[model samples]
Target: MIRKIKLLLLLSVFAIGTAVADEGMWLPSLIHKLNINTMQQMGCELSADDIYSINHSSLKDAIVALDHGSCTAEVVSKDGLLLTNHHCGFGEIQQHSSVEHDYLEDGFWAMSREEELPNPGKTVTFLISVEDVTAKVLENVNDDMTEEERNKAVRKTLDQLTKEAKGDSHYEVYARDFFNSNQYFVFVTETFRDVRLVGAPPQALGKFGGDTDNWMWPRHTNDFSMFRIYCGPDGLPADYSKDNVPYQPKHSLPISLKGVKEGDFAMVFGYPGSTSRYKTSYGIDYTMKVTNTARVEVREKKLDIISEYMASSQKAKIQYASKHARSANYYKNAIGMNEALTKLKVIDQKKALEDEFTAWVNADQARKAKYGEALGLIENYYSDVENDKAREFMTEALLRGPEIFTFAYRVKPMVEMLKDPESNKDRIERYAEFLKIMADDFFKDYDASTDEKVSAALMKIYAQETKPALQPTCYQEIQKKYKGDYEKFAAQMFNKTVFDNKEEYLAFLDNPSPKVLEKDLAFQTAVQIYEKYNEIRNLVDARSDILEKGERLFVAGLMEMQPNKKFYPDANSTMRLTYGKVLDYDPRDGVTYKYYTTTDGYLEKEIPGDYEFNVPARMKELLLAKDFGQYADADGKLHACFITNNDITGGNSGSPVINGKGELIGVAFDGNWEAMSGDLAFEENLQRCINVDIRFVLWVIDVYAGADHLIDEMQIIR
Candidate 1:
């Protein structure tokens, strides 16, 4: 009954007309009631209904969650042409590239519809609608119930709600908990599977600045990619086929030729990934010391090893391009997050908030009864994170550090089934076939020698950095048999393991024997590592309930304590809208940064023959000739990128930066370096969303790349 009442109070709070300017990831469904007025006041010309409406198509229909929120993309043409960041499509591009035809170097442009390449596993999901389901999810859930019982009840209710929401439709339905599980919402979606690669600029432009300029400002990276969605004859989601036609979207964004300017109204709409704005001080400390530390330590070694192999040959570089970039991106992010958190004194801020929360709770007996234990519960659970730290280390340095163990772990089930003589032959055969297919894909990108070095180096780091007691069982053998020399062990393991060789692995799969598998050192090590991994996981999970409950109660108490203040939920890969403006900033006392960058700045950053800053000859020629075509701004300078104060994060990489008039101005790709801690705390004075100017994107397509056919499809508003 208490839980139900609390939820009802939360619903009322949700409708209150309090707005936190430039600091929220507002839900599209609730904007009509919660944020429409403020958004309009800030320069949004569209009504709330025009942004999201189930009765008719709105802007929501034009947006897509790329690969279920790994990134975001927007429909730019009536014929299903989609625009996203180049790095978002890096994997597919890398998959289709080879040494002989280096697409990453020369770039890819589909001159005609028939020339576009299909990506089998890629998908684009359009939201059908979102509805609040908090009351339904909390049904039969009460404060009297134990945490486990409450969870079970909520899960049961969510399952039922999802079923009813998807009744008799092809749409996908799922529910997400917001505000620390105090509120619930159900989303209905249509996922189209036949997404195709349409075009991308070469690395020279798309990823021009590379790691050196990744999270920094004044960025000139093009950072954009193009893909097309294909649908079945009836305009429903379908698998990739030659017969599929371009999807006719309900709405598409009109590209604006009127360029960005300082303080102009801007809005970013997409899925921003996970953020912990309400994380306690203890959680922040653990993230800096354990999570980020482990990632930086392990990935540094792994990246160095991969870089060496990549330098060995072009084939090796192509094979590891996407893998290296993916690992390095977050690896650097973790490092920067820690630096920014410490420099900004985020932990101190959280501690002060907790102190105030405690005072508020103590001042009133009623508040005390509801929230007195929240901080205690949170602090107590986080005080002992030894097992959690070890688990993080194990994940980065062993399980995910080396590719071999994870790939080998896949066959564990099949091996177990093979051990049972009474196991069904058909089931075993089907599993074997699946393993064969897996092996084919794995070996295509696998280089045993490179993996061996990475495995050895990362294992050494794990042994040196982590406590000995938490080491996996295989480490015991390494100490006893190999004298703790990880390199020797890795060498012997790689030489003997059939998992390292595709043909050998295929042969072994053809003839299954448990006895033979038991003798395999890599398989034995993988099983032991996974067992220890599970043990640590269980230990950490055992203590997680207290933290979960504490956070929920704390968030609830905060709402009650401050009834008039507006609050926004943290990012959780759900569609959100954030309104701000195109504005410059002062990074330091002496630095006044500009809001935009031009092609001249792009040229100024060039280092001739350098890997990261080398300009392509054709691009250099175009820039030297000042041939920017219709895409150049009024100043007659070709703008490369710009900055806006719009709030964004990881999954928002390719989100469209829309102007007040509901037109695409740029494609948001990164956030400024000064506010790397923006995810945890909105740095109102410093945080900026970096974007590739739309005019620059068009210039590349119309003049440099000569892909004018692609531009003909867009509805350009000059």
Candidate 2:
């Protein structure tokens, strides 16, 4: 019923000829009713059914959510040759890397099928179908119910709906809320677990310009990697086995050598992680002051410690490579987001919109009765953020900063079983064996000394940034016993804790004792920190509900007040289609940025002996020789990357940029720095999706690495 109203509202907007182009992450399943005309007007050659269909294979079949939506990947060959961003596959690459075979520095390529590296516990999920389940989920819910009761009712229905949707099938079924829980959808998905690494360029090329160039325009990073999917003999999802064969995909994208030019229609289809487009001014203030600030402060210190260890040896570098990149990516984003939010005057704009809503509601008694308390509820939620601020700092500094606490916390259940004298001997033995395996995985990349330093530094910051009452009890112990010397405390804990030494920890696990676990300082500290964190969470739970309810009411009221305006739901890690054109913009006064960058620009940015900007001798030779082969543009230059106005976010990192004819042109990777505030509120003119030209990706794969065998599998169109 709600879906019908939304579609009618959208149709009315088009009927009045007031519908705008672009700037939305629209659902692909509803495009036929809501956006097909607009997309056709924008020069898309394919019909709605060609892009997404349940009865027949379509473009949607080629795209899969990598690792269940951390990133996106597209099949480029019938044999399930998948392409995604290098960073999306960074963790897998780092895991396979070592001092003897540093895949991060030297890159990895499997010349033969037998050489491909299988990734256990990795998966790629394909959407089988999506159905609107809002009516069903909300049937038992009502405005009279408290938020807790409402949630219970909704969860009960969602569980039954998902079970029915997945009945007698191997598919995974889940429900996602949209438009602030005003609507819901159920998705049936197929997940293939046997994913393998095929090839990836070295960090020098894949991550060129590194932190200095990330999220900036004119990007020269190749930023692409290749993988393959394997299936069982019956052609279904299965575990890794030598007997498995390459998956035969229903559809695969055809590569287009006809590079993109400005004004060329383009589209991206992927699972966008999340966006709070309707966030109020108070919420925005909280995000900048508390959320972003805590992340930057905690990570600023964490990255320094990781980098110091990384520089100590190649082994350490490989161990911390993925961890550092993951931390730094968001640390920089938070800084950039704060800057963009302030400079763009987003809070002022939101306040103005709130004022307008207030005026509109006051003009009508009916609206006043429905939405009079919307803004008040939201404001009240943010009225006192002292506890909230402490919570965010605690989360960043203690919960996430040091790896040791969380790693040690994993054995809490095992300790409980040991404490119970009635626990079965076999059950205890099984858990001990499980802990041994976990210890091996944990200690593989962990350096206790590094963690020790991180814990001490972050603990000090947490003490200073948060109020004394919010500090964990462990800090109180430190203050009394260690004379407030966190360094001394950390040193003593590191020396005494069995967790710092894997062999000692495993030996202790062999003959585990409840008394020993109780006396362990690290375990005791972890328990204290987690218990306090939970206390903080409970303190804020009621206030968070206020914000959630206010936002939902505000959105629903706005839709009713403006019946002619078309509204799209915020992203929630579900498949969406956003379309636009290859275009450039002037980021600021008198500075018109170009739509594309070339190999020449890449060389110009090179710095000798610099890790971030150093030029590979082979890459330099090829660039200077102008040996781009067929990948060169009409101007006889090798284009590195291009920009488009298509709306995208984090999880869309490796989505394919398809032209009007549905041929792959580039791989969507980053968003320009000018629009770091885009996740909160999109700035259409400044928000550009940065993509690595498919030609550049191919050039590195075929020419630079001379791995032509991989190229032969793709269907290329000139």
Candidate 3:
């Protein structure tokens, strides 16, 4: 299964020895100093100030962070009409969906303002500014201080600084560390709480090819979704209200129907989440062997159970669509990432880097005193992998696997609240109300039969794979009482458990008692799982300080050793800019993938009856007519999706793919499967960012869905 031969055949380069051209997610504030000249040389017509500036309107004003960097969106209309990926907005879409409405199947479009759907917790965050506060945050900590004391000092400083930053403003302030706590920055942001769902295409169009096409090239998925932000008459953020009006943003990106070509300048601006490009080889090995492998095994089984039920019922299809897609997305990524990392020999390359670092330290006594033990610390910690494997299996197979245990765990706070009702009367009342909301949400998507099957298989897997001592108390009870017959035990538990019905559960909460909860099988199982989880966590915690300090020192030493190389800080859910040109790649010896996919490609891949490939009759008719309107290229081909070499990660989903003139061309949604290892090490030639072209987005909106009224709000250029 090792693909080193294929790797050698495809790539002439041995391994990613260092950062190469078009790498690094540079901070927007530092673009002038770091990336502007190179970007212009590549084809960019915009200046640094045009991309990011405080005194005037800039591209940053249009880019918004959704739910604190979970995804990105851009303003496309003067009235705050927003555009992001279908998958990014899937949760809200699922929440509004029902068996009757079936919004996920037949998409929703708000013809007017009154028809728009409002989501409760959804918010669009705009970055006002960021300032370095490292010296202030670390002012009270010392090297000699213990980790606990150091944390306390840092928290106190951050709290004070955040308070100073907020003042009388309504903006939210966040201070986060960079480079494993070696640097820090305070961010000021304004968040609009009233975000309304405007339009989306049906899954047949938006999620075309679903899991099979995710993270792969030649994608035809029109992954875009639309939303709008509303503000008060004063043009400030406000909660959802009838009185609120459409927000007039400082800037909006113009959509260019003039499509992307090979080697065209492309830039992505978004809030990228975490990446451990500075991780030690030991850490990479642990991820590959334990974490990634465990996920691959567990999620595949989970997906099988869900997929079976989803195929049989439309209810299951809507309920588990989000959950299934999430699990499957990472499942494929892990399988591909493990193979890519091994084939690329990233671990060996990292070892060579560390060896050179060791030599550099040995040459100087002061350097040795500072960094000599960093690698040893990492090695000693990772040597405990034998202990870590069982913990991973137990977590994946038991703690997170069963839905009943997870639901029962929610009652832990309610149990404590009932214990002292007189002193916590108000809190208990509030929690009871919250319990109703919780039940409504969970049971909407709950299929008890599916969970029962999943629980039985996972329980047996946990029993078979784990050591006797590592198994939870519940497993021990299973062995003694049921003789390890998970099927019989699951049947009894599902039939007898109060959690199987919301009405019975709520009736008990009306006059809850500790004895009632103590005898509950689901609650009992959850407690045992948590007890073992804490045991493993404590075991890991005992050695974590050394590991943490070692990681910090390793990055510091790497920066020192390669002083001439331009080093960008690792992403930590902060805004960044990565620029590259649109290009194609050869995944294998005889196969070369084109940079862009077209409408004809969509018709070519249809499977007739498959939901992933099937489309609406209207869409097929439009394609047959070849009436793309203004969204086709000079060659008269309708481009659907395209690729660029822009450096991006998970949180960059829904980010705006901007052209040299600061016009929107696409929305980034996924990364290529070949270089899934880019999270650990950047493979410059193989790594690619996948985007849905803006032209295809509009084509689907205006022609396929007949939502041309929504198109009237945008500034589109032919």
Where model 2 places Cα greater than 4 Å from the true spot, the runs are: 1-19
Q: Which is the better candidate, 2 or 3, if ranked by TM-score?
A: 2
Q: Report the lDDT tens digits of candidate 1 across residue range 1-718.
A: 0132344333322211233477788888888877788888988999999998999988888999999999999999999999999999999888888888788888999999999999978999999989887777776787788788888899999999999999999999999988888888899999999999999999889999988899999999889999999999999999999999999999999999999889888999999999887788888898899999999999998999999998888899889988899998998889888888888888887888788789999999988987889889998998898899889999999988899999888888877687675656788888889899778668878899999999899989988877877788889889999999999999988876889999889888888778767888888888888998898899889988999989888877777766666667889999998889899999999999999999998899999877689999999989999977688898999999999888899999999999988899999999888888877777778889999999999998888888999999999998
Model with the higher TM-score, candidate 1 or 3: 1
Query: lDDT for each of the candidates?
Result: 0.87, 0.88, 0.84
Can you give the lDDT of residue 44 in candidate 2? 96
Q: What is the lDDT of residue 161 in candidate 1?
A: 91
In model 3, the number of clashes is 0
Task: Locate the minimum summed-lDDT window of 10 residues in model 1.
Answer: 10-19
Candidate that would win on lDDT: 2
lDDT of 3 by residue, 1-718 (tens): 0011111111111124756547887778778776788899999999999998888999999999998889999999999999999988888888899899988888888989899999988999998888777767667876677666777888889889999999999999999876666666788999999999998888888899888898889799889899999999999999999999999999999999899889999999999988888788899999998889888888888889999999998888999998888778889989989988998898998888888878997899988887788788888899876557778887888877878988887888877877887998888778778877888888888888998888988888777766887777878778889988998788877876778788888887676777878888878888788888788778878878778777767766766666556667677888999999999998878999889998888888888879799877878899989998899888898898999999999889999999999999999999998888988888888889999989999988898878898899999878
Q: Which of the predicted structures, 2 or 3, would earn the higher lDDT when compared with the native?
A: 2
Candidate 3: regions farther than 4 A off: 1-15, 138-149
Error of 2 at 191 (Å): 0.8
Cα deviation of 47, candidate 1, in Å: 0.4
For model 2, the local distance difference test gives 0.88
